[model samples]
Target: MSLAPRAVLVHRRTEYEELIAHHGTPGQAAFFLASRGRSVAEVEQRHRRQAEALARAAAAVPLDWRRTRVERADLPRFLFEPEDVVVVVGQDGLVANVAKYLDGQPVVGVDADPGRNPGVLVRHRADALAALLPAAARSGARHLEERTMVEAVADDTQRLLALNEVYVGQPGHQTARYRLAVDGEPAEPQASSGVLVGTGTGATGWCRSAWLERGGPLALPGAAAPALAWFVREAWPSPATGTAQVHGLLDAGRQLVLTVESDRLVAFGDGIEADALELTWGQTIRLGVAPTRLRLLG
Candidate 1:
């Protein structure tokens, strides 16, 4: 009977101490871990080890292997629905995606601080479903870890969280230099070639790499936090193509524009490139930060 009712376990193994420490009761919390991606032999080995570890921590904790509990469940339709806390051991992207299933429940990342009783949480850097959890603007959002769904149901403030980064890259030449306007001011790339805006969260992903490779400065636009806009470096090898098949845009601020100048380019959502657009210039495309964030339990 944790103060938070029930918690959903996200990691594969270990970190059970945190769940036990935070739990008001032993059997109140439910756990789930991903064992699908691995081979049958690997999964079995990992599963046995993790189950033993968890069982030792809290004999009451129920380990469910039904629904995948991911951006999309990978395997095993998780029998577990939603829980109070979600402990994430992987990166922000995975955490953020997992956050979606919990309906914005308190997800903590395992960046546990010194002597924090495993009660530490890493805020997500990317992932829309995660960022929409809650905001500092809302009173309830402040006291996160202790929140229960019943107490914080009406939450609607937008918090932008990106694990990787929100980028607008290019495709023409091996490198592309474009003019960036912060609030409509000229901020061009000097040496490395493109410009990107990043939040502290985004700083962890692409923007951070850009910084390492001389991209540009990372800025947080709070007044318009709900929007995750990217000016784009214009990746069209050819030009703009107006087919939805050519999904990318050139965000110009005025009208959301899209065109096909035989734009030979590719756009990637999360470097996965599984979802990209063939983009061009002059067409104003819109890209804003996601309102939700990825939450994790450390």
Candidate 2:
């Protein structure tokens, strides 16, 4: 017999929860916030909204279906089944956080506090899950979408995926040294802060900021486009290094290859620097669009 479908609810700890965890009690959390000239009431209100949203999402799951909850921090250790229906009940970043670890399970982005968040990824209200979940659980559902993701694969076979952009550089603020070769072009020695390669899903945030700073002519791809854009941050041209190839686009099959020349470099995605891949000298990493897309519910 086929296995029953499962609903995996994903969320992150709210600010109030974090404060309480750190302060040990509500009174202490309030006092800590008051000392910093911040009001704990706002945090509490947000916490309530998050709880209400999560409850609504939970109540909407089909009674016969299996259900489970996974916090953002625990996603790295969580095992997702093929038939799981992911419901992220938090800010848009939480959806991005879960996207990297998923294979092709459809994700339902639930906006806990709608007006407060941009609602780019988490576009659905919690209450909407009542109807959405039923349709999502059905086989051959057409209410799903595929969002492109970027992947970074090191020469050692260490690979990292991101829903947004990937950063390649030193873990610290120090300059990074690498030889960059785009597509089949000749490699150019570069000394800069780092390199950023991102998908269209990430174009509006960090990728846009870098593109605006340099005002590059290349247009960023759309959310579902099979393409990626890359930018070299603070490329300092030296007598030994060049900056001729600063920013460009990577089509479906194209890749941006980087051979590390620094003592050590890190490749991280979607701002999760803590779980990044470490690259030593002479190591090479390739950045390209991943074959697996984020199966998001529309």
Candidate closest to the true structure, highest lDDT: 2
Whole-structure CA lDDT of model 2: 0.94
Each prediction's RMSD over C-alphas, in Å, is 13.3, 0.8
Q: Cα deviation of 183 in candidate 1 (Å)?
A: 5.8
Candidate 2 deviant stretches above 4 angstroms: none
Q: Assess the local accuracy of residue 20 in candidate 1 as a C-alpha lDDT between 0 and 100.
A: 40
Please report, in order, the local distance difference test score of every candidate based on alpha carbons: 0.34, 0.94
For 167-241, candidate 2 gives per-residue lDDT tens digits of 999999589999999878999999999999999999999999999998766899999999999999999999989
TM-score of each candidate structure, all chains considered together:
0.42, 0.98
Worst 10 residues of 1 by lDDT: 147-156
Our tally of clashes for model 2 stands at: 0
lDDT of 1 by residue, 131-216 (tens): 32233113345545421100000012212223344333454334443323333333322212233434344444554554544344
Q: How much is 139 displaced in model 1, in angstroms?
A: 10
Clashes of each: 50, 0
Q: What's model 1's lDDT at 91? A: 36
